[model samples]
Target: MLNQLIHCSLNSGSPVTLTATEGLSSIAQHEDALLRHLFQGYQKWVRPVLNSSDTIKVYFGLKISQLVDV
Candidate 1:
């Protein structure tokens, strides 16, 4: 689905362009290259938990108080 859009954009020479110092071979290569560029330096690991070393316990709940018949 996305590949079709990339192909159309590449063929039509839209304002948006993707280039490399060397070159990309095909549409798949172009897509992979674009993804790599887009997600470069993205981390999948947690860096800090509220900037603290100790474990934090988060508490949450909902209270309901009512007497009715409906």
Candidate 2:
């Protein structure tokens, strides 16, 4: 998000024209990248756990809530 903001700010004077669809598609791509990165981080943190059943319940339940907002 900070990188994107910085890029936009630095390119503020650049003449870049994006159609509505293009803008939305770019945003969707960024969102997908961010989500994949986040999920990988979560997996790396929790995948070496002790109890599979409890981890599954906790991770999936929390993921479901986050997915709802996403």
Candidate 3:
């Protein structure tokens, strides 16, 4: 993906410039799908409230444009 972005950046008249956002959004959408996939299998182990078996709800989000170098 980085290579493709670089290629688009180097091309002066590429129609692909506007399409970059589509690529980026697709990546983000996949992240949402991945989270849903995880929750589908792992919700059983999560205890949002202790001492109870009540049904729980979870929400998730990502912090954009922030880099963490570990």
Candidate 4:
């Protein structure tokens, strides 16, 4: 599921990218192992998107902070 979401986020249109980011935010909030897995995926797939979009980069940063706070 995470792989599929990451694939969709990487390959799909902007709206799907946004939705996938939002879903990733939710998953990060609730699941530590999944969040770690997500970060591994991030290193491969999501990092480029971060370079392209400030909004997503900031959101992803906030989600990381949320994990730290927990």
Candidate 5:
């Protein structure tokens, strides 16, 4: 799982770019499945509150994206 997650995180961004959310957008499984295979510890803390009516907001560069999985 570590290797798979590491590979995914590396591929999520380009050679020189990194995509780590430092603040609010902390909970996510991002591009290249960076957050998918990894972040289990963080996910556990956030998932219980991610109810059907809730929404996830992500910030990339200067843009904000919203994802709602019901």
Candidate 6:
């Protein structure tokens, strides 16, 4: 599930990218283990996409605030 979301976030077109962002947001708000996994996946897969797109970066900036501390 997270792998698919990370793949979409990294490789899909704009519409899928938007949807994947929403999914990523949801996943990020999960328990610490899941959130940490998601971040690891992001660093490995989605970071390039996030780094290259200002829109994505902004969206993630807001969504990251929803991540609770472990």
Query: How accurate locally is residue 9 in candidate 3, as Cα lDDT from 0 to 100?
Result: 34
TM-score ranking, high to low: 1, 2, 3, 6, 4, 5
> Per-residue lDDT of 34-58 in model 1, one digit per residue for the tens?
7775566778665558675768677
TM-score against truth, every candidate: 0.34, 0.32, 0.30, 0.19, 0.18, 0.20
Per-residue C-alpha lDDT of model 4 across residues 9-65, encoded as one tens digit per residue: 322242222123337666665466445544553555445354555544243333333
lDDT of 3 by residue, 2-48 (tens): 42332233223423222233466776865675456445546666576
- For model 2, the run of ten residues with the poorest summed lDDT: 2-11
* Colliding residue pairs in candidate 5: none
Best-performing candidate as measured by TM-score: 1
Instruction: Give the winner by lDDT.
Output: 1
Model 2, span 1-70: residue lDDT tens: 2233422221235432222233666778776765564455354555655776654435443333344554
Would you list the rank order by lDDT, best first?
A: 1, 3, 2, 5, 4, 6
Cα deviation of 26, candidate 4, in Å: 16
- Clashes in each model (backbone N, CA, C under 3 Å)? 0, 0, 0, 0, 0, 0
CA lDDT scores, all candidates in order: 0.58, 0.47, 0.53, 0.44, 0.45, 0.42
lDDT of 2 at 38: 44
Question: Model 2: residues >4 Å from true position, as ranges?
Answer: 1-22, 44-70
Instruction: After superposing candidate 6 on the true structure, give the runs of residues whose Cα lies further than 4 Å from its correct spot.
Output: 1-30, 41-70
For TM-score, candidate 2 versus 6, the one ahead is: 2
The C-alpha stretches of model 1 lying farther than 4 A from their native spots are 1-16, 19-25, 47-70
The clash number for model 3 is: 0
* lDDT of model 6, residue 25: 58
Error of 2 at 37 (Å): 0.6
Model 1 residue 46 CA deviation (Å) reads 3.1
TM-score for candidate 6, residues paired by index: 0.20
